[model samples]
Target: MNRRVKEGTYKGKKFNAICHFFGYQARGSLPSKFDCDYAYVLGHVCYHILAAGLNGYMATITNLRNPVNKWRCGAAPITAMMTVRRWSQNPGTASIGKPAIHPATVDLKGKAYELLRQNATKFLLDDIYRNPGPLQFDGPGADSKAVTLCVEDQDYMGRIKKLQEYLDKIRTIVKPGCSQEVLKAALSVMASVTEVLSVMSSSPINGQSSL
Candidate 1:
């Protein structure tokens, strides 16, 4: 999605013109020099991640990333997955909300997808590995070393880490907690994080403020 967005009308026209005259360089024809180096050698990754038993996931032909076929898999939440959108108003039972979980899903609970979800990371290089802080200029700085820090850098990332931990804590405190200290901590976390984000809400362009 980021690549597509970056390649606007002008970029699209350039690629189309080049292909129209000389054809894609991958087809053994090119105009000048083209360096198409991608991280993670596509050789072995494609074979297994695109192997049997996952046909619908492989959408390579449509210029779509990650073929949605047999072997490879990507995932969204069950709540997000539960959304089966209607196309042309042709549905028997229009299910809009999350459906009741079935037995088959429960059987596949401990699989790689679930395990992958539980595996947390503190750095990232790609969208698959990292969300990259929501396209930046809009939120707290990324915690990754690779990402350059912005305004209030230390205070921002610090508050963000605390916010994430606090949210996780909220998930575990379902047993009617009367601990005022914990309650206050959660509220303080919210206030502090919001303050950082609010200041960062203005995009800094070459160290100049956006009036």
Candidate 2:
């Protein structure tokens, strides 16, 4: 990548040769609003998982497009989310396969990438730039958040809404005089759903505890 950037020419113009890496500087900067909220909720979720005595699991909070309170908390088995990859143990040792969580990549078929693909020509030649400016806590820019979060939230909500409807149907069909065990199980499930919704309805900024 560096070689291409240093030697490549676009159109009829030759590019200047300068290689700079900004990863360290960017990583050392102060957290943005999104970063702060995301980290806080993730930490809270991890605490809950630990308190629940869960092991070999990763804490996650989804639906981040919504407020922190609305974020959905869940735990996923680490192995379930990882893939096996070949890695060298040492220079003298043989390579071994290891399970690892790889960094996520942009989906070529996704809308975001598709839009970028469509505008590639324009972006290559036109020196158009958009300054997002500093991250804000309140106002118009704050409202304009990550598109990925919104997309994930929409997908999650759709599935959850369907499950809720199924649960409601089951409730309607079940008799009022159902067995104690059955009623207890149903109530437990209902309570769990209600708790999630209650959390969603409250505001994290108002000191409401998020699951």
lDDT of each: 0.40, 0.69
TM-score of candidate 2 on Cα atoms, chains taken together: 0.52
Which runs of model 1 end up more than 4 angstroms from their true locations?
1-166, 174-176, 207-211
**lDDT leader:** 2
For model 1 the local lDDT of residue 109 reads 49
Q: Cα deviation of 150 in candidate 1 (Å)?
A: 22
Model 1 score (lDDT) = 0.40
Q: Ten consecutive residues with minimal summed lDDT in candidate 2?
A: 202-211
Please provide, for model 2 over 1-211, each residue's C-alpha lDDT reduced to its tens digit, 9 standing for 90 to 100: 4566568633455657799998999889666678888888788888988999999988776676777667777788786555556557678787676556644677788777776788899999987644357767777666555555654434454477788999788878666877888888888987998999886655332232222
lDDT of 1 by residue, 33-126 (tens): 1112111233344565556444433221111121123223232234322222223345676534323322233323444445445543522433
Q: Which parts of model 2 are misplaced by more than 4 Å?
A: 1-28, 83-97, 102-105, 122-131, 151-211
Q: Candidate 2 at residue 51, lDDT?
A: 97
